[model samples]
Target: MSILSALTLSRRPATGFVIVGIFWGGFAAHVPVLKAQLGASDALFGLLLLGTAAGLVSSMWLAPRLDRTLGARGMQVAALALALAWLFPGHMSVQVLFFVSLIFVGGASGLLDVTMNARVSDLEAQTGRSLMNANHAIFSVAYAVAALISGVTREAGIPPGWVFTGFSVVTILLLPVLRMAPAAVEPEVGYAGAYPLWPILLSGLVVLVAFMSEATVEAWSALHVERTLGGGAVQGALGPTMLGITMAVGRFSGQVVAERLREVPVIVGASLLSACGVILAAVAPVPALAYIGFGIFGLGVSVVAPMGLALVGKLVAPHLRTEAISRAAVMGFSGFFFAPVFMGLVSELFGLRAAFGGVALLALCAVPLALALGRYPLRTAQIRP
Candidate 1:
């Protein structure tokens, strides 16, 4: 491999996430097209989204076994299938094609979701460093670009024709990217025995709360700006944009610090910052402070998930690390998936501001979890699988 390609492959999690970012960006962009094609209600659109949630959950059931059998090569293949799945339905009716593609993308995403983290865990062994947060930050960058492209195209009056045509180009590009990954097990340096589930479950609980706050900001930050702070709705949309920008910056910097300051304090400090930001934003009588608060919260969450994943990666053995990751991932996914409903119920009872801002409380709760994680920080020598 060229030195550049080798350096690139060294960043396995980021490389894996490149494929993920493009699809996620494009699929979200494609949602309107699906709506146009299916003539479906917003309610039905939500139901269709359920398929993705189902696929994600379902993959957890099989991911452990798949990881055991196929290793990293299997993950590479899964990435390929995920990229290609978007290329389907060339000849089908729009509605049928929309649903089919969604299901395919969901399954493909689920597989990648489980396997890539496992590979990150594996790569950490070789490098003996905490790099997973940097990898995830790269994914966020890709998603930002994707979302930007989609929005620009729509605003420019470009037809959805560009969606398939452009995204197909990304798929073709990812094939070369996936083809060059390092093998998973040429030189396993740590234990490969069965992993204890208790720590993993604890990790999952932490992930769940972390994700709950993350999801809330993602979906409701703007609404909070408009409804509570009396901002123009257009101004409100900037919440996640600011959040994303700050978060991308924070995660990139945090990865550098992951080796220097240690993950535990970085995480606990981050959680506290996030919680404070949300609470400030929630109570702010003006839109500007709310935006500032969202920015801080985004920066805080930037490292928590990746740090959590790195911890899981560090604790387990090689063959079983993949399962350990997905186990935690499943719980986190459930938390994010259910957060919206919980918000809705809370909104009905209290108000959108109260319900939406409650996510700050989730971040506040993560403070102790972050500290507890320090008590059992994953040792570098023990990372495998």
Candidate 2:
């Protein structure tokens, strides 16, 4: 294939990442509107958010089978499902209906997450390239862009329903773009067989820690700035904004080094830096210092999930890659599910500072796991190039 063809094929997965980022960024900006629409208190809103995690975790169980059966088509189908579900939440007036809508939305996100990663990993295996960090970097950049735009529109008094409608249209428009690339095929095996459970569990553990640390910052950093440091709303918003910008920069840097550096050192160094960042945030005397800490934290944690996923991709046999990734995603995303709740509970008991300290601890937990993953030799498979 020519260079143009390869570049086009590579872009398909990155486009999916951008769409996912748009949903999440817009969703974050719209949370206040949804709360007002439903008149939900803090506890009630947390429960409603929990439904998404429940749906996400539950749907992950089926994602592997879906991908296995449909191959690349599974990603397109899930993205469509996510896009359609995206529009429903904006229209929901009843609490029950809204809760149910989130379930569908989360389920689609879960499936799309697994399918897209599997597809990207397949593409990397086929091309002998390091694509995961670059794809994830695009995700971070899209997220930052969407959040900034949504913030502006929210300030202009735009209804979230209108914003969501735009997202739906864009998502649908991207379907043909997703279909531009040929489907990735599972590499042939001598006989159909099961993948070993250990690698999945180990890699999944690292992902869980990485995601939990990241989610803690995203969910609570603003609160930490406002409540703990007595900052104004503008200062509070800077918390996540700084983190997002630094995260994009970090992942972009990772894209350049991913192929050259071994996964272990990358993960180990990133985790340690993330741990120190959270610790600094936990101890910072002022909001400005906390912002710097969060920036450091974002920079450190940015490359972790991509590196872990790439390592898992390298470890598994090609034919079994989808299944292994599904298992790992289930573990990884559980952190996304529970991290905020965990932080909330800790904050309630000990205060937000201690809660952030707990996040730093979680980052440190990944260090040993990264070392273990380093010990596993990469398995070579015959794949298309």
**Best by TM-score, which number?**
2
lDDT of each: 0.66, 0.79
- lDDT per residue (tens digit) for residues 1-385 in model 2: 2323433657887788888888876775565567678887544665667767777888899988776676657768888999988888877778888889989988999988887887788788887877787777777777667656666676677777788888888999998766533344546656564665777888999889988888778766766787799975456656776777888888878877776788889999999999899899999989989989988998999999888888887888876777787888899988867785787678777888999999998998989998888777787755564
Task: Please provide TM-scores, in order, for all candidate models, with all chains considered together.
Answer: 0.79, 0.89
Clashing pairs counted in every model:
2, 0
Candidate 1, which ten residues in sequence have the lowest lDDT sum? 1-10
Q: Give me the runs in candidate 1 sitting further than 4 Å from their true place.
A: 1-9, 25-48, 84-103, 159-165, 180-195, 220-237, 280-290, 347-351, 377-385
The residue-by-residue lDDT of candidate 1 on 88-160, one tens digit each, is 6322346555566656666777787777776666677776756677777776666556645655665666655
Q: How many clashes show up in model 2?
A: 0
Q: Lowest summed lDDT over 10 consecutive residues: which window, candidate 2?
A: 1-10
